[model samples]
Target: MTISAAFSNALSGLTASGRASGVISDNIANALTPGYAKRSLELTSNATAGQGVRVLGVVRRTDPVLTDNRRSAEAMSLNADNLARFHADFGALIGPSDNPGSLTNRVAELEASLITAASNPSAPSRLDATVNAASDLAQSIRSAGTGLRDLRTRADRTIGQQIDNLNGTLQDIEALNARIRRVQLSGADTASLLDQRQQLVDQVNTIIPVKIAARDHSGIALYSEGGAILLDGSAATLSFTTAASAEPHMTQANGLLSGLEINGMAIRTEGGASPIRGGTLAANFQIRDELAVEAQQNLDALARDLIDRFADPAVDPTLAAADPGLFTDAGAAFLPADEVGLSNRLELNAAVDPSQGGNSWRLRDGLNAAGPGAQGDAALLKAMSAALTDPRALASGNLGTGVMTAGGAATAMLSITSQASAETEQRASFAAATFTEFQRIEQEIGVDTDAELQSLMQIEQAYAANARVLEVVGTLMDTLLRI
Candidate 1:
């Protein structure tokens, strides 16, 4: 090779080695940084007459298939976790059978108090105890029902927040795509831009799982798993109006609540037909519309049974046909049409509730006993106790026909809630395990300091070799000049 060519080749080699060292340094530095991809400097042999190496830009190394899998698993894990949390929260509201303050336990307490009161009908303390137990049972069911409404409200607000975040993320991705395209057009490295875009896409995936499609100039398009276009040339607008508080009678179907809209079109956000059904957004909708509604229904059913069982004229006949029994719906008879919010309005009969200026001896007599005439008559109290344990087929709430008494209905409700909670938790565990495995694999293939150090060592050797070549070339040129 000519002296000039050898010198040129050596300088180019040194430049390529320096760039490679910089890339290795970057890899080692960002090893633990979230969303930072390992980078490698692209090189080409410029061996025409020994010119040396060409630096083509830096490339970000990532496994697209593995990243896609991990993202899907992450969405699934979050969905399962949200559902499990909803069911568990509802179960806690109703109280477990083992929990002393649970709905089932309250029912049993009221039943026992009635029997104890029946044994000593004239004792004021025993009568007071029965009334107090009745009050507690009603309050427990009411609190649970109210809690379900609150869960729905909170979930609705969360859905709004998630939708906002999703929209913002898509817009950011769109802007990043533009920046990346410009960089690519300018023949510059877009590795950092690509990394930023990936992080934004990850955020979007968690909110509403989406699939990425390759676009020209290192840009990308996003679409939902169910084929809804999220970002093409522009981002789609997602909208949801949150309610101040969810009510028993309020529902999207009834036009009292809002459903999700994409680009101003109503979209199904529940059941198997939902376009966005595998992320945190969907989970919040399920909590707001499905789980909480079903739980409220079941609680209302229990309350209905308790109210109807005692409302029977045969159970407390000292009054007229319209007189409510020990339990009432907001101090009145429970109409069949009003069962939707019965649990929320469930209350002790004001006539027997001492807190409401009622007499305790009324328990030994009747709800409308005309000022408690019978001081020693345990018949009514025993009858009320029987009314509590009487077998009756429940008409609603999907508690099945397996439950007989009011206590049995409450037990069935709690059991169903607890079982649902457990099943959802199990699914969450499986999803989390899958997500963990995928994440671990992705991390394992991520930046390795040891490997980067080895690469640095190789780059150092190349730099040294290139410097030696330059030294020899310079020495030969000097000798030639001297000759």
Candidate 2:
């Protein structure tokens, strides 16, 4: 071969080695970055084309099938985790009165006072203690209601932040798509641009799964799982907005980024879906709606049950027709607004006042056939205690059948909370196992140290051989000139 030809071939070999080295450097740099796919230089022999060689592009190492499966499993695991947290928080609110100023303990204290009062029908000191117990129970209910409302408010704020993040990520993805298309059209090296774009796509996946499509110029287009196009070409972009109805919406239009839009879709809904998933957005939405709101409703229901049952003469004969309930419904019908539930109509009746009605007024369970006026006060108290312990009585619509005495709401809350705690722990364990398995499978298909090292050795030897050829060519050229 001519000296020039030999020199050129050697130069090409050096270039190929450099490219391989760059790929190896990149793989090592991002070894720890989550969702980072490895890449390799795609080289083609130039001997066939009557040229030195050509670098096709930097191709990312990935398995689309494995990625999709991992994402799906993550969604289910996250759902379980969120449900468990909801129950845990609710459980905290539902347990015994001894929990550092918990309402359940306060209610129990009041019940003890009432029992004491019953023992000495005419003792003024006993009556006063009974009144104090009732007042304390009312305070406990108010605090619990406030705590639940606070949780709801925090959830709302988190939802707003997640929506903002989703918008930002979509904009970035659209912009990257435009850059990639432009590079491809200009016949420039678009390998790095593609890498950046893929990284963006991976980020979007964490927020929600996306469907990617091929573009005409070897470019890519992204779409939501729902078939709404997120990107088209250089002329089209998807935009998202919070509509007047405050619902999340997405739309596609003109310009690199003007078309695609997403409006008010929370991380998840009742039927289990949202435009976004996988990452923190899904977690936040679950807390806001399902966990926080549902717990609030459960507490509200319990409160209403307490108030309506205690205010009736059948449950507390000392409570006259005009008197308000013992614990007072401090909550509005759908009220998280005021952060408290109370009955405006609850008050002990003065006519058959426990202090003055010959100390004859009694507390009765709903099952007693005798009217409040006829049942002995002692029989009513026993029935109320029995009702508080029975879940069936609580589930039944008959508040009179089981007057949830002081501490009853606390007991019910504890039960709900315990169930939730178990669920949360179980879900977390499952998620951990799933994540570990996914990583194990991915490592098998991912970068292999032994393979890359062996390839590196071969590339280096080829580079050295090519350098020797260049050196010989230079020596020959000098000798011929001397001759």
Best by lDDT, which number? 1
The C-alpha stretches of model 2 lying farther than 4 A from their native spots are: 1-4, 48-52, 96-107, 116-136, 218-221, 226-268, 272-293, 314-318, 330-410, 448-454
lDDT per residue as tens, model 1, 174-278: 999999899889888889888889899999898788999999988899998977889998999998888888898899999888998889998999977689989
- Count the clashes in each prediction: 0, 45
Rate residue 184 of model 2 by lDDT.
Answer: 73
Worst 10 residues of 1 by lDDT: 45-54
Residue 61 displacement in candidate 1 (angstroms): 1.4
Clashing pairs in 1: none
Please, what is the whole-model Cα lDDT of each candidate in the order they appear? 0.89, 0.56
Models 1 onward score TM values of 0.97, 0.72
lDDT of 1 at 348: 95
Candidate 1, backbone clash total: 0
